[model samples]
Target: MHYCPYCGSLVIEEEKYCMKCGKELPSDFDERVTSSKSKWKWWKYPIIISLVIALFITVLFVRTQQQENDAQELYQQAEEMALIGDYQTSKEYIEQALDHKNNFPTAKAVLDFLKIAIESKNTINDIDALAKNQNYEEALDKLTAIENNISGFKGDLINKLNTTVSDYRNNILYQQAEHKLTNDLSKDELKELLWEVEEITDEKAEVIKEAIQEKIVAHTSNHATELLKENQFNQAMLVVEDGLIYAEESEQLQSLKTTVEKEKIAFETAQEERIEQALTIYEQEDEINRNQAVEVLNVNASVSTNEITVTGEIKSVATVPINSILVSYQLKNNDTQILENDVYVFPETLYPDEKGKFEFTHFNKEIKNNDLTAEVTKITWFID
Candidate 1:
C-alpha cells in the first residue's frame, strides 16, 4: 500500500496517483507521505482556528445589528406615541429601547423628555378632574403654575385644557347669574349681576348677559307702568332710570321714560289751565251774577315751614236757600304755575245773604309769595 504525498489517501503500490484526492505519490512514498502529513497537520489547525474565529465574528455582528434595529424601532414607536400625547406608553417604549441598548444617548435624551411630558400630561389630567369636580379656582391655580413654570409647553393638550377651564369657569358664572335672575332682585342687584356676566368671555356668556338684560328691562318697565298707573310719576321715572344703567340701549325703557315725562308735563299744564279758567270765571262780575252762585271775599293766606293755609268767606247770592256750596282754590308759584288745587265743601243750607267760612290747607314747601285764587265750583239748591 502507498499514500499520496499531497493528500492522505491510500493507493496500490503500482498506482501513480491516489484516485480519492487525485494527488500523485512521491518517490519513497511512505517517507514523503509521512513528512507531508506531519507538516500539513499544523497548517490545518491554524486555518480551522481562523475559520472558527471569523464565523463567530460574523454571527456577533449580525446579532448586534438586529439589536440596534430593535432599539431604533422602539425609539420610533416612542416618538409616535409621544406625538399622540400618550406619554405614559411612550415612556414605556423608550425604557424598553434603553433596555435594548443601555448606553444609547438618543434614547436617554428622549427618555428624559418623555418623563417631562408625562408629568405635564398628568398635571393636565388633574386639572381636568378638578374642573369636572367644580373646583375651578384650584384648577386654575394649578394650570397657571404650570404655564408660568414650563416654557414652550403650549401644545394641543395644553390648549385643550385651557379651553376646557375657560368654558367651565364661564359656565359657572352663567349659572350663578341665572340663579340670581330667578330671584326677585332689585334693579341695582340686577345691574351688578349684569356687570359680572359681562366679565365672562365665553360664547354662552353673551346669551346669559342678554337674558339678564331682558329681565332687568322687563321688570323695570313693568314696575314703572304700575307706578304710572298709580300717578307716582317720580318713583316710576327713578325705576326706569335705574334700568337704563343696566340696559343702556333698551328702547322699551327709553320709550317708557319718555311717555312718563310727556304725561307729567301734560298733567301739569292742564291743571294750570283749569285753575286759570276757574279764576277768570270768578273774576267776571256778570258771569258770577248770572250764575246766582256764591261770592268769595276776605281771602287771606298764611305760610309755614311745611304747609300753606288759605282762609276765605263765601256768601250765598242765590234767591233761595242753598243746601250745599263748594269752593275751589288754587295755589300758584311765582311763575303763575299752579302748585296745588283743592275744593272745600259746605254741606249745611245757606239762605240768601248768609255767609260761610272756607279754608284750604296744603303741604306745599314751595308756596312762596304768589297769587291765590278761589271760585265757587258747585251750588246745590233745596227743592221746596
Candidate 2:
C-alpha cells in the first residue's frame, strides 16, 4: 500500500495517481518502473515481436504519466474551490479525479467533510418544513437523521431537539385520552384507560388523569339529575353515595350531596305504601339406606385371672369385611348388673382389616375374689 502524499490516506500501488488528492506523478519515477519489470527481461524473443512489445509498453507508460498529470491539475483546482467555500464545485472536481484512480486516499478525506456539510444543510431544511406543517412526528425523524449523519453539531441543538420530540409524544397521548374520556363509555372501560394513562409520564399523564377524574364526576352527576327529575329521594341518595365513591374529594361530589339533603325534608312525607304477609308450608320426604357397623362382644364371666383377653368376630348385617375393631371393656364386679352404657368412643378415621385383639386388665386392687366380667360398649375399625 502507498499513502496519498497530500492527505495521508492509504492507496493501492496499481493506481497511476492519487485517487483522492489528484496529485501528480513523482519526478524520479524511472527507477520505480524499471525495478518492477527487471525480473522477466532475461527471456529472449524474435526482434519484430520485441519491437512491437516495446512500442506497446511505451504507449502504456505515456498514458499512465499523462493521467497522473491530469489528476494533479484537478487537485489544485478542487483545493482552490474549497478554500473559497465553493464546496459544490470542489465536490464535482474531486469526483472526476477519483474516476482516474479509485484508490486515492486524499480525495476520500475531503469527500467525507463535504458530505457531512451537505447532510447538515439538508436536515435543517427538512426540520423547518416539518415544523411549518405541524408534523411533529416527521420533524423528530428529520432531527434523528441529522444526529446520525453528522458528528460535530453543537450539544445544545441535540438536547433541544430531544426535548421537542418528548413533548410532542406526550401531548399526543394526552389529547387521545381526553377525547376518549369525553365520550359516553362505560365506567369500567374509562377506569381501564385511566390506568394506562397513568403509565405515561410527564405532562401527558397528568393531563389525562385530570380529564378522567372530571368525566367520572360528570357521569355520576347525571345520576343526581335523574333522581331529582323522578323525585325518588332514597334512590337519589344511593346515587350520590356512588358518586362520592367515584369522585372522592371532588367539588362535584360535595355539591351533589348538599343538593340531595336539601330536598330530603319534603321528600320524606311521600313514602307510605306497604304490603306485608307471612306463609309457611311443611313437607316431608322419607329415604332408607342399608346401615352396617361392627359389634364386638365379650362372652366369659368370672375369668380366673385379673388379666383377661377378649377375642371375637364382628357381626355385620351385610357381608361384613372384618377389620381391626377397637374393643373397649371396663372390668366390673360380677355382682354389678350390666345395664345399657353410653360410652363415647373415638373411632378411627380409616377402616383396617385384621385379627382384632384387645386385653382388659382389672386395675382395682381391693377386689379379693378373681370374679370378673367384660362388656363391649363400642366397636371401631382401623386400617394399617
Candidate 3:
C-alpha cells in the first residue's frame, strides 16, 4: 500500500502518480515524510468551555442591570405621587416594587415626602378646627401657611380664600362705619344699608384689590396720626409701612407718608435745636462761673489812642496743674465772624495753690459791630 503525502490517501504500489492529489511522489518519500497526527493540545477543550461560561455570565449581568433600572424608574414615580399628597397609593407602589430592587433612592424619598404631607394635612385640620370656633387670626395664619407650604393649591380653593378675605375685610369696615353713624335709624335699616355697601365694595375689590382704598388708607393714616400725636414718630412710620402694603400706590397713602415724614423731620429738627440752645446756655453759664472763680490779678487797662491793654488772672484752686492756657476773643460782622484773637498764657505753671496773671495789648480797628468774648482751649494737665 502507498499513501499520497498531499492528500493523505491510499494507492497501489506500482502507481507513479498519486490518484487522490494527482501529484507524483519521489521514490524516497519516506525520508521527507513527517507525522500527519493532530497537534492541538488537550487543554483547548477547557478553554472553549470557559468562553461559553463567560458569555453566559455577561448575559446574566446585563439582565440584572436592566431589571434594577426598571425598579428605580418605578420608585421615582412613587415618590412624585407622595410629594403631591397621594401617600396611600404611593406607598402601595413602593412596597410592591421594593423586593425587586436594591439601593432605591426613591424609596427613601417617598417616605420623607409622605411624612411631610401627613404633617401638613394635620396642620390644615387643626386650622379647620380653629376656624370652626371663629378664631379667625389663627385660622388665617394657618391658611396662609398652607398656601406657602403646599406647592400648588386648587383654583377653587384659591377663589374661596379670596372671597373669605374679602368678606372679612368688608365685615371689619361695616362695623367701623356703624360705629361712626350715630343716627337713630332702626337696627334693620342701618344693617341693610351697610350690607348693601359691603356687597358692592367687596365685588369691586375682587376685580381690583385696591378698591378699598379709602378705608385701608384712612385707617392706617389715622393710626399713624395718633402715633405722631403721641410723639411716637418711629412707630408712626411703621404704621404707614404696613398701610402701603395693602394700598401700595394709593395717593392717600402717599400723602399720609409724606405728611408723617415732614412731621418727623420737623420734630427731629426742633429737638436738635432745643438741645443745641441748651448746650449754648450751659456753656455761657460755665464760662461765667469760670470767670468768677478766677483770681483777679489785674482789672481795667489803660487805653491810648493807638492801643488798649487788658489784664486777667487764673486761679489754680478750680484748675488742674496746667502748663499753659489759651484764651480766644472774637469780632463779628452783623452775623458773620470777622476777626479773632488767641492769647496764650505761657512759661507759667498753675498748681492748685498758685495763681498767675498776664497782660495783653491789642490794636483796635474801627468796625460796626464789636462784641468781645473769651474762652479757653488746650489746658493740658500733667499726670502726677
Candidate 4:
C-alpha cells in the first residue's frame, strides 16, 4: 500500500484520496503498490469446490436459457476463472457480464461476492507478510477493517473470507499469548489478553487458554496466600475473587477463598473480643462514655498545583485510651459538590481530653483540580 505523502496515512494505490487525512495523493505513490496479485498459491488456491460451482452453473443456466445471450456466456466464463484461482480475471469477467446485462440481479450478486473474494485473497497475502515479521497489531487492524465491510458478501465468497479471518485471528492470538506470557505484566493485564483468545470458539483457542488459566490461578492463589499471612484477609479475598472470574472451577482459587473467609472470621472475632475487654476495663475505671466521644477540630485545607493537603485536629473524649484512629473525609468543590471520599489514619493514640493532629496529602501529578476543600465525615478509634 502507498502512504499519503502529506500525512503518512496508509492508502491503497487505487485510492485517490487518503482515508485518514483526506489529502490528494501524489501520482508517484500509485506506481509502487499497483502490482497485480494475479494468482493464488497452490496451497491457498481452490477456495470453492468445482462441484458447487457446477451446481450453481446448472441453476443459473436454466434461469437464463431463454435469453441464450452474451451475459450468460460471460457469467459462465467468470465462474471458470474463479474455480482456477484467477480472482482478478474472474472479477473482470463478472464486470463484463454486468455491462452486457445491466438488469441481471444474479450477475450483480456474483459481481459483489467476486469483489469480496479478490479483496479477501489480497488481504490474506498482506496479513501473511505482516505476521511473518511479527507485526500482529497491523495485521489485526487490516482484518478488522475488511470485516466491517464484508458482511454483505454472499455464497462461497463469505465462507472463504470467514475461514481466512478465523485462521489468521487465532494464529495471531496464539503467538501473542506466548510472547506476552514471557513479560512482566500484572494478572489483570494477562487475564485481558487471554480473554480475547478464549473467544475463538474453536480448538485453536483452547490450547493457549488452558495454559493461561493455570498461570492466573496459581499466581493469584500465591498472592492471596502471602496477603493472608500478613493478616490482609480482605485484600486477599479480592485477589482470589478476580482469579475465579478467569478460572471459576479452579481448585487452588476455591481453596484460597475458603482459607480467606475462615481467616477473616477469626480475625474479626478476635478484634471484637479485644474491644469488649478494653471497654470493660474503662467502665471499671469510671472512664467509659459510649456516645460518639471523638470530635474533629481545627480542620484546615490547603491546595497546590499537584496536591490538596488537609490538616486537622482530633480530640478523644472516650472513656478509654484510643489508638489507630481512622478519619474519613470528603473533598468538595466551591458549589458543594463532593469530588472524592477518602480515609486517613491519625497515627497516634489519644486519651480522654487529649488531642492529636493529622495531615493528609492527596492529589497527584495526574490530578486536574486541587482547589477542593476538605469535609470531615466520620472518625473512629480502637484500643491497642
In the order shown, what is each candidate's alpha-carbon RMSD?
18.5, 28.4, 25.2, 39.2
Candidate 1, 30-123: lDDT as tens digits: 5444444565785699998999999999999998888899999998998788777687898899899888888798788767666665665677
Query: How would the candidate models be sorted by TM-score, starting from the highest?
Result: 4, 1, 3, 2
Please give the range of 10 consecutive residues that has the lowest summed lDDT in model 4: 34-43
Query: Clashes in model 1: which pairs?
Result: none
Task: Name the lDDT value of residue 40 in candidate 2.
Answer: 34
Q: Considering summed lDDT, which 10 consecutive residues are worst modelled in model 1?
A: 375-384
Q: Please estimate how well model 2 matches the true structure, expressed as its whole-model Cα lDDT.
A: 0.57
lDDT winner, 1 or 2? 1
Error of 2 at 37 (Å): 45
lDDT string for model 2 (69-182, tens) is: 777677678777765556678778878878765777877776676576456556666766666556655665665665666445333333444454445445544555665666
TM-scores of all predicted structures: 0.41, 0.26, 0.31, 0.50
lDDT of 3 by residue, 46-118 (tens): 8878999999999988888877877777676765665555666766667656666756755655555455456
- lDDT for model 3 comes to 0.58
Clashes of 4: 1
Runs of candidate 4 with Cα error greater than 4 angstroms are 1-77, 80-86, 92-105, 269-384
Backbone clash count for every predicted candidate, in the order shown: 0, 9, 0, 1
TM-score for candidate 3, residues paired by index:
0.31
